[model samples]
Target chain A: MAEGALTAELILGTTEDVLRRYGPAKATVVDVARALGVSHGSVYRHFPTKAALREAVARRWLERWHEGLADVAHTDAPAEQRLRDWLSTLFEIKRQKVREDPELFDTFATLMRENLAVVDDHVTGLENDLAKIIADGIESGDFAPRDSKVAARAVFDATNRFHDPIYAADWKAPTIDVAFSAVVSLVVSGLSVPD
Target chain B: MAEGALTAELILGTTEDVLRRYGPAKATVVDVARALGVSHGSVYRHFPTKAALREAVARRWLERWHEGLADVAHTDAPAEQRLRDWLSTLFEIKRQKVREDPELFDTFATLMRENLAVVDDHVTGLENDLAKIIADGIESGDFAPRDSKVAARAVFDATNRFHDPIYAADWKAPTIDVAFSAVVSLVVSGLSVPD
Candidate 1:
């Protein structure tokens, strides 16, 4: 079963690569199969149609992103540290993907915006987790009584906005890092207990 | 001379409309000249090439933006009120552009990013203006002593980030206003002088 899963993962990765290169309109099952050096029949065995293949690829990518989030969600790190790590992870992924192909970055951004409903559940879960950590900090007297939900949303939006340049492959990491640190520090200081 | 300047301005507006309808790659000088119901030779009299016409349209847009800033820079409004108006005007213009044509947004954003040197200078001027206001507030015992440069950058980035959805045509005014207030309150609360 493990070997089967690994094969499936590899096939999905290849499918996404083809999709990114050719766009959804031209990225057919046969195209993916050809790129993977596999028979069309073998591709059909895994994904019955092009739509199914695309759906599977998107789901796989979201699952991988969630898995990364899960890895850090419950770590023993302080709340601020966790938030920074999460923001950094997001930027790193975006930057690496942008470096791979600018068109792919645009495609991914458009897909995410157009299909927010598809990932709503995962986003909600992440938001809840973030809010809980923030609330914990407040309860422990480390943070002020700012609205955690609003704060979390601001952090999410600010970080995502900074990824625009990254998606366009025009980002300077140091400058972006400075912007990121400023945002994180400002928010944290705003929420910190009075001296 | 005034008549000539008015004709040039009209031609610029017509060209912007045409370029916005069809992007620079597929858009043509003939199309713009035709749209304006002017002779192709007339357009050639003003702009030698399609590239020159596109650049003029972009320059006009930037000029209008800077003019708005200059008009408000010497207003007698308090620092916070001036800051809010500046942000609002910036976003209102973006929202108007998105409403005019969604596709034009990508064109504008792309042009702005590609010309970051010019865009950065505009932002730096705004930041310097904001820093002075912040410094005045500090001296007047309304704000705390924080790194004005860093703090100004944070305010600029956060407010600009909030304008993303407006440019995308996915934001409501009330929601964005709430967000604007949140950032403003966060900054003032975080950096305000204690009584």
Candidate 2:
């Protein structure tokens, strides 16, 4: 990486650390710069404002989430299996985040809320990943032929209760796993081509 | 109605008005009592506590929601049409509440959150209503044989994004209606018995 790019990467790492330590509300550009043993001006050169820095950190976090699911989307398994695995993996990833470090998870959620454009882009990317799996199912004659992109959106919306942040509180319900299985089964059945 | 029962009804009506005017955070038993030209002690005799009064108001609101959905659940239409209409009616009712008077809707949401038991009962009642429709579909040989209660719960969870209060923001998206239709179609197809 170029020298400036390397510095920017270091700044983002320190910002993540500061956010983890002090939370979104208290974390500041000065804290990140101080942690890096650099001046606030240096941080400002890389990120125009505090919000920009926070948005970058949130984007980085979401990028990791996408990367985790990308493998499942491209696996060689049958399309139906891949789709189930993909949705389950996504739900597990989100649930684990909440379980392991809810404070940090909430921090990123707040940052993401402030960065609506970033969230929109991330959602669109996820839909595209789902579309790829649905397209494969259609090609394999397992799923009914339809617009994969549209199908992907419908599936994503339908499963929102399992993975959406607002529903995080209900994630711990004893029957949540069963509910997740039921929903995935219904979606798979819905996609199956009728005999 | 008996005199005490009448007084209790009056107290609840005044509580609703007070909650709507001041929002959940500021509304109090004294406010309700004052609005009804009764002493705070009189309100307490009916509700016992401010929380009790709030819970009653929230329960009343949810009761009305159930009443609205009860009609679609019992209609003479085909099971499939009734299911679709029931789900759509729920989405429309919730969306209208949010759109027509967002402040009051939010107030009720706050009250509902504070009263978890009331929320749970309300959810169970909705799921039962859905189960009735699913049971009818099964009886008519339109839907595959399965536990109607389980299928109802699954359908309810699958369509959470459409009616859940937390997703109120997305309800306004231009494509939301199309998305609702797609989900409902997928659900209906999922329930259909194969040859």
**DockQ values, each candidate:** 0.40, 0.77
lDDT of 1 by residue, A140-193 (tens): 777665787776655554444454432344354457678767766666665566
lDDT of 1 by residue, B1-195 (tens): 232443667778887787678775677888877887777778777787766666667666676755666445447776666656766776677777677766877777766755656566667887876777666666667766477788777766666555543336445445766666666565555566545
iRMS of candidate 1, Å: 2.3
Per-model TM-score on C-alpha atoms: 0.77, 0.95
lDDT of 2: 0.86
- Chain B superposition TM-score per model: 0.70, 0.93
TM-score of 2: 0.95
Please give, for residues B96-150, the per-residue lDDT of candidate 2 as tens digits: 9899988988887788789999988888988988899999999999998488988
